[model samples]
Target: MHGVVQHSLIILAVLTSLGVIFGLVLAYANKKMAIEVNPLIHIVEDVLPKGQCGACGFAGCMAYAEAVVTNPDVPPNLCTPGKDPVAKLVGDLTGKAAAAVEPRIAQVKCAGTHTKAVKANEYHGVQDCVAANLLFGGPKSCKFGCLGLGTCVKACPFGAMTMSEDGLPIIDPDKCTGCAKCETVCPKKVIAMMPIGAHVRVNCNSHDKGAVAKKACSVSCIGCTLCVKECQYGAIKMDNNLAVVDAKVCMEKCDNPTCLAKCPTKAIRQAVLGIVPGNEETVA
Candidate 1:
């Protein structure tokens, strides 16, 4: 019993001595190796939205903040969620001019909802959009339309997108961070990033000629170039039966609603301005 007691006391003494030695080592290391954090890091982080959406092409909000604080070339307006206010704050913190950034939102280019598009064949496997797209351009007759698999909705970390009744995704612009995650996930390339407050967008993604597009979907662009002819500002152009609008040019020169009325497919939607009378629900 005495021997066991002596061993226990020795073990306790050894443990106490080791603890003291470790404590001193930790204190010395802390004093010698402590890093001096930059004050600008905190300032930059304060102005950030804290959403960490990665819209600024960085890993997260903290990383973007650090880059903005340390790098002179990094623009202050990289945070899409913070918008102009955060830009101004960043500019103040960094002592740099805030670059003017045009706000953009995601829009679904394809209007080929389940009702409008005929199914090419039944898919029997996974419900993932990317997976479905690999199987002969998905189940829809319109090869370049949304697969209605909710891939974009799933990719969105902000919960900004929801599947509509027609099986197409609808984005809540108010909630969207403009992170471009949806634009990346779409297999059909139907989702596009466009300037916020733009008047109109071509909803159809079909590149087939008029009759061919018409057979596939009811509201496909027919490459008629009617919009090109109608626009006085030369904003609209026809390429592969798709109408592309230069938003800056369209905003400056094309204020009239003639093109919306002239489109046979009614695929172009004037989202900002009210639709003209007698063409309220037109497809183009």
Candidate 2:
């Protein structure tokens, strides 16, 4: 009985010694290999709204925080969703100049709908716009028009985009962070980032040249260069047979925009649906 008791005690002592040795090793390893986190990173991260929208060019708010905290040159105004207030806070924290956030929103270029744009072939395979586009430039006659397959709507991480009943993507300005995700995801390149204050814009993306474009979709830009000619300010220019409006020159020089009245097919328009008013938000 005494030998049994001594054996049990010996086993307990060995186990206790092993545990202590492991504890010491673990402590030493932790002290030597532990990553040191900067307090400023946490501070900057807390100030941010944590949208993880990647508008700041970083993967997330934490990544941005680490960048701004560690680097003196990284600008704080890259956060589009944070707006002016966040910019100011980041600037104050990092001692960097807070550049004013330009108000930008996504604008869908195609006005071609299910009824307006003539169908070349009925797509029956997949609902994906890119997938549909792979099979002979999509079902729509206009090669550059939006496929209305909800690819953009699905790509939007912020729930800023939606598809209308007429088969067109609609972006809510309030929810949009101007992340340009939809623009990147769109296979047609139909959606583009536009200044919120931009009054004049070309709604069509078709480069079909004059009559061929008109036949495909009624609202498609025929690329007649009428808008380029009518712009008194030289704000409008022709690129790839399409009317390109320079917002900088247009805002300053376009007091009497005759371009709106000059478009023959109503292709060059004020970026609106139904009633093309002089000043109103446009629809796709």
Native-structure RMSD, model 2? 4.9
> Which segments of candidate 1 are over 4 A away from where they belong?
1-34, 272-284
Q: What is the lDDT of residue 184 in candidate 1?
A: 80
Q: Write the per-residue lDDT of candidate 1 for residues 1-284, one digit (tens) a residue.
A: 99999999999999999999999999999999999878888878977877666789999888988898889899999887787888999998889899776778788887787777788899877989999989998898888878989999998878888887778888787787677878987888988888887777888888888888888888778888988898888888887779998887777666675788788878876753222211225523
lDDT tens string, model 2, 17-121? 999999999999999999999988899899887767677888989999999988988998888777788889999988888999887878888778777789999
RMSD of each: 4.2, 4.9
lDDT for residue 245 in candidate 1, whole number 0-100: 84
List clashing residue pairs in candidate 2.
271-282
Clashes of each: 6, 1
Clashes of 2: 1
